[model samples]
Target chain A: MAGKKLSIIVFSGTVDKLMPVGILASGAAASGYEVNLFFTFWGLNAISKNGMQAQPQVDKNYEQMGPMMMKRMMDMKFPMWHQMVREAKEVGEVKVYACSTTMEFFGLKKEDLADFVDDVVGVATFLDRAEGGTTLFI
Target chain B: MSQEAKIAKTLDVKGMYCPGPVMETAKAIKQINVGEVLEVLATDPAAKPDIEAWARRTGHQILDIQQQGGVTRILVKRAK
Candidate 1:
């Protein structure tokens, strides 16, 4: 059977939201699904070279628990969100895209993004890649 | 369990969680030849169901699934 595809629109930069993006991508890829991740807004910022190394942030509602959650994840030896995405790419067809409009709005260049980003794209390209597939806005 | 099948590889994903066991199993299946069996030993509660779903979706065959203590053992045959 031809593998189904999963399209995720990453709009949040918070670790809480990003973690699900990584986990879902890996889960779909493991089930032989092609994954398309469109990073926009804060999501695009989070994938930037500097953002990749920056301290993880949780939603304001969970701000107090963020440190404890991070510590627990670390103690459990859980892979970082980006690391999970990388592992997903290794097993199946997973493509990560950074929104060009977001980059321009932030005065960011392609070189400023993470190495795992497959390309800088526009909404049209993302829609084209995401057509006829399961789509999620995160 | 009925037929005696030879396992070509054994993947230990005991400490991994969620997609880890499934991802590892998918990668390991590629390392073996077609029709060769891949045995996955995982402790993740999701491993068995996730791997079973992966096998069904990828055209692979699940030969056996056995759980002992907290460990789950899965035997998968690569179809392609």
Candidate 2:
């Protein structure tokens, strides 16, 4: 698994969708795989420094259950979604990338993103790094 | 039912979810020397299979695994 890669395109900003991105990235990293996360559209919101501190937003359909789920996770002392990705980075080769187009759309600069973000890149650059790897769009 | 190997570290990851146990195990194993044992105690129901998969992929050796009450005890030896 030396050269194995796991690439994820994060398109959703909801906590529900973001949870798996963190889990999968951590799991793959733990297994000695190279992990890449490409944040775009609403998903780019999550990497924003401010967004990282904001209250987690869930899908409208799960709005009622969101509070209960968050409570249970807190009671269990589970790490937040972004925290998991952070841990993955600490454990292995994990890179976080923000979409350049989305950055322009949201008027976000490199300084606006979380410190964990590696770079601001376009689709071509993302695809180049994601080539021949297992890519997931969330 | 037999004797267990001496453990170099004990990671108590109780109450964590799926990837937590595996991630902690990966990090914990690195802290120990090669051929040493790292014992992992987890409450997550998925810990057994998840850790097993992690060991298989990372080339670590699982010396033993036992489940009792709600906790799963996994003894993993660092292979590399």
Which candidate has the top score in TM-score? 1
Error of 1 at B29 (Å): 0.6
User: B1-80, model 2: which lDDT tens digit per residue?
Assistant: 43699999999999888798999999999999999999999999999999998998899999899998999999999999
Query: Ten-residue segment with the worst summed lDDT in candidate 2 chain A?
Result: A72-81
Across B24-71, the per-residue lDDT of candidate 1 in tens digits comes to 888899999999999899999999888988898899999999998999
Model 1, span A1-138: residue lDDT tens:
585899999999999999999999988897889999999999999999899989998999999999999998888788888998998988889999999999999999999998889999999999999998899999
- Candidate 2 stretches with Cα past 4 Å from truth are B1-3
Residue pairs of candidate 2 with colliding backbone atoms: none
TM-score of each: 0.97, 0.96
Give the Cα error of residue B11 in candidate 1, in Å.
Answer: 0.6
- TM-score of candidate 1 relative to the true fold: 0.97
Interface RMSD to the true structure, each candidate: 1.1, 1.0
lDDT of each: 0.92, 0.93
Output the lDDT of residue B80, model 2. Answer: 94
Per-candidate Cα RMSD to the true structure, in Å, reads: 1.0, 1.3
